[model samples]
Target: MAGIYLHIPFCKQACYYCDFHFSTSFKYKRELVDALVKEIHLQKNYLQGETIETIYFGGGTPSVLDESELNRLLAAIHANHTVASNAEITLEANPDDLDKAKVNALRKTDINRFSIGIQSFFDDDLLWMNRVHRGDEAESSVKRAQDAGFENITIDLIYGYPLLTDAKWKSNLNKAFELQVPHVSAYSMTVEPKTALASFISKKVYPPLNEQQSASQFMQLTDAMREKGFEHYEISNFCKPGHYSRHNTNYWRGVKYIGIGPSAHAYNGFTRQWNIPNNARYMQSVQQNIIPAEVEELTEENRLNEYIMTSLRTIWGLDLDRLNAIAGGSAPLLLKAARHHFDKGWISQHEKIIYLTQTGKLYADAIASDLFF
Candidate 1:
C-alpha cells in the first residue's frame, strides 16, 4: 500500500522561522486549486497501482482551503486511484483557522485526523514567532475539533528557541497532555538560512539558540511523555498505543507515495521527484497537462543511505538483514562502521537488530551519516 500527500501552498502570513514554499497572496487561489486537481489526475499512475492507505493534506496551512475546494481535490483522487476503505486522511491546520464554524465545516469532509500547528500555548511566544494565532485560540481549536467528534488529533510544538524557557517548555508539554491529543510531534527550533529568525540572530537583534537548553528541553519532553504513557516512537514523535501518524510512519518505512501540488515530493521505491516550487509556473504547466518536475533515479548507494537515514531515526532500528538484501556483503561494512558507536554505548545490537540508545538519538543524524555506505 502507498500514500498520497497534497501540499496546500498558501498561508495567511509567514512564520518567522518557516522556509517552506508558500505564498501569502490569494490572487491565484482558485487557479491553484484547479491546478492541484489536474495534477492529481496527471500523477495518477505515479504510484503504480499501489492502494493508497493514507491521504495527507500538508502545507503552509491546509485549513486555508474551504469545504468545496478540499472536496474537489479529494474527488479527483478518488476518480484516479484506488484508495483504501479505512485510509487515514489527515489535514494539517493552524489553530487560528479552526474556529467553531470551520470545525463544523471540516466535519462535512472526509478528514478523519488533524495535525494542528500549536507551536506554543504562550501568547508572548506566539507573537515572537509571528504566528497569527493567540495562545487562547490554540487551546480552543483542539477543543472545538473534539467537540465536533474528531478524536484522532496530533499537535505540533516547537522547542529550543530563545523565548522558550525550560519552565515554559514543561508547561507546554503539560498543556498538551491536558488536551489529550493522541500524538505529539515536537521539533527543536533550527534557524534555517534565509528565514527571519536567522536574520535576527545575524543582526544581533535576537539571541542565538542554545544547544544545551535544547538538549535539556528534549530530555524533559521524553521523560514527560514516557511518564504520561506515551510511546517515543520516533526521534521527535510520541504517541499513545496504536495512535501513530500513519502517513508519516509510511514515509519512514520507505512506502511509495505520490505528492500533489507545487513544491511537493513523491517517491516510488526506485526514483524520487518533486514538483516545481513556483505557483504561477506550476499552474501554467498543469494547464498544458504537464507536470513541471525534476526526477532522480536512485543509485544503489542512494537507496542504502536513504534507508539507513530513515530507519535509524525510528523505534524500528536499521534492519541488518534488510541491508544485506539491498546489497549482499553490506552489513559487515555497516557493523564495522557502527563499532565506535557501540563502544560509546550510543547503540546496542541484540540478535542482529540494532537499536539506538537514548543517548544515540541525540546525535541520530550524525550517526546515521557515519554509518552510510
Candidate 2:
C-alpha cells in the first residue's frame, strides 16, 4: 500500500518561525485548488497501482480551505486513484479554523483523522509563535472536534521556545491526555534561516534558544507521556497504543508515496521529486498538463543513508537484514562503527535490529550520521 500527500499552500497569516512554502494571501486560492486537481490527474500513475493506504492533507494550512473545495479535491482523488475503503484520511487543521460548524462539515467528509495545530495552550506561548489561534480556542478546538466525533485526533505542541517553561511544557502534555487525544506530534523549536525567529535572535530582539532547555524538556516530555501510558513511537511523536500515524510510519519505512501540490515531494522507492515551491509557477505548469519539478535518482549509498537516517529515529528501530542487503557487504564495517555507540549505552542491538536508548535519542541525528555507510 502507498500514501498520497496533498500540500495546501495558503495560510491566514505567517507564523514567526515558519519557513514552509506558503502564501498568506488568498488571491490564488481557487487557482491553486484547480491546479491541485489537475496535477492529481497528471500524476495518477506515479504510485503504479499500489492500493492507497492513506491520503494526507498537509499545509501551509489545509484547514483554510472550505468544504466544497476539499470535496472537489477528494472527488478528483477518488476518480484517479485506487483509494482503499478503510484508508486513513487526515487533514491538518489549525484551532481557529475548526469552529462548531466547520467540524460538523468536516465529519461529513471521508476524513477520519484530524491533526490539530495547538502549539501551546498558553496565550504567551501562542503569541510567541504567532499562531492564529488563541489559548482558549486551542482547547476548545479539540473539544469541538471531539464533540464532532473525530476520535482519531492528533495535536501538535512546540517545546523549547523561550516562553515555554518546564511547568508549561508538562501542562501541555497533560492537556493532550485530558482532552483524550489519541495521537500527539510534538517538536522542538528550530530557528531556520530567514525565519522571524532567526532574524529576532540575530538582532537580539529575542533570546537565543537554549539546547540544555530543549534536552531537559524532551526528557520531561518522554517521562510525563509514559506516565500517562503514551508511547514515544517516533523521536518527535507520542501516541496511545494502536494510535501511531500510519501516514508518517509509511514515510519512515521507505514506502513509496506521491506528493501533490506546490512544494510537495514524492518518492517512488528510487527517484525523489518535488514540485516547484512557488504557487504561480505551479499553477501555470499544471494548467498546461506539465509537472514542473526536480528529480534525483537515489544511489545505493543515498538509499542506505536515508534508511539509516529515518529508521533510527523510531521505536521500531532499524532493520538489520534490510540494511545488510543495501550495504553491499559493507554492513560489517558499519556494524563495527555502531559498536562504540552500543558500548556507550547509546543504542541497543537485539542481535540485528538496533534501537536508540533514551540517551541516544538525544543525539539521534549525530548517531545516524556515524552509522551511515
Candidate 3:
C-alpha cells in the first residue's frame, strides 16, 4: 500500500526555530491550494496503481485552512485515486486553530487523526519559541477535541532549550500524561542554521542548546512514557498500543508516497522527487502543466544507506536477511562491526533483528551512519 502527503505551506505566524518552507501570508493561499490540487492530478500515476493507505495533511499548519478549503483538497484526492475505505487521514494542527466549533466542523470531514502542535503547556516556553498560542489554550485545545469525539489525537513537545529547566521539562511531560493524549512527539531543540534561534545564539541574545541537557531530558522522557505504558515506537514518537502514526510508519518502512505542494517530497522505492520550494514559482509551473521539481534515481548504495538510516531508528530495527538480499556481504560486515556495541550493551540482537538499547537510541543517527556501507 502507498500513501499521499500534502504540504500546506502557509503559517499564520513563524516560529523562531522553524526551517521548513512556508509563507506567513495568506495572500496566495487559495491559489496555492489550487496548485496542490492540480499537482495531485498530475502525479496520480507516480505510485503505479498502488492503493493509498494513508493521507497526511502536513505542513506549515494544515488547520489554517477552513472546512470548505479542506473539503476541496480531499475531494480532489478521492476523485483522482483509489483510497482505502478506512485509510488513516491525519492533519497537523496548532492549538490556536482548534476550538469547540472548529473541532466539531473538523470531525465532520474526512480527517480522522490530528497531530496538534502544543509544543509546551508553559507560557515561558511558548514565548521563547515565539509561538502564537498560550499555555491555557494548549490544554484547552486537547480537551476540546476529545470532548468533540476526536479521540485519536497526538501532541508535540520540545525540550533542551536554555529556559527549559529539568523541573519544567518534567512538568511538560506530566501535563501530556495527565491529559491522556494517546500519542506524544517530543523532540530536543536543535538549532537549525538560518533560523531565528540560530541568529539569537550568534548575536549572544540566547544560549545554545546543550547536548547533555538534550540527552538527559530524552532519557527522562523515555522513562516516564514507558512507566505509563506508552511504547517508544519511534525515535521521537511514543504512543499507546495500536495508536502509531500509520502515515509516518509507512514512510519509514519505505512504502511509496506522493507529496503535493511546494517543498513536498515523494519516494517510489527507486527514486525521490521534491517540488520547487517557492510558492509563486510552484503555482506558475502547475498552471503551465509542469511539476517544477528535481528528481534523483537511487543507486544501489543509496538504497542500502537509506534503508539502514530509517529502519535503525524504529522499534522494528534492521532486518539482516533483507540486508543480505541487497548485498550478500553487507549483513556479515554489519554484524562484525556491531559486535563491539553488543559487548557494550548499547544494542540488542534477537536472531537476525537488531535494535538500539535505550542508551543507544540517544546516538541513533551516529550509530546508523557507522553501520552504513
lDDT of 1 by residue, 57-113 (tens): 999899999999999988998999999999999999999999899999999999999
Stretches of candidate 2 off by over 4 Å are none
- Output the worst ten-in-a-row residue range by lDDT, candidate 3: 337-346
Query: Candidate 1 at 129: error in angstroms?
Result: 0.6
The positional error of residue 248 in candidate 2, measured at the CA in angstroms, is 0.5
Question: lDDT for each of the candidates?
Answer: 0.94, 0.92, 0.92
Residue pairs whose backbone atoms clash in candidate 2: none
lDDT by residue for model 3 over 1-373, one digit each (tens)? 8999999998988899999999999999889889988998999999999999999999999999999889999999998999999999999999999988899899889989999999898998899999999999999999999898888999999998999889999999999999998999999898999999999999999987899999999999999999999999999999999999999999888899999999999999988999999999999999999987899999878888898889888999999998888777789898888888888778899899999999999888888888788
Segments of candidate 3 deviating more than 4 angstroms = none
Q: Please tell me which predicted candidate would have the highest lDDT against the true structure.
A: 1
Whole-model alpha-carbon lDDT for candidate 2: 0.92
Question: Which parts of model 1 are misplaced by more than 4 Å?
Answer: none
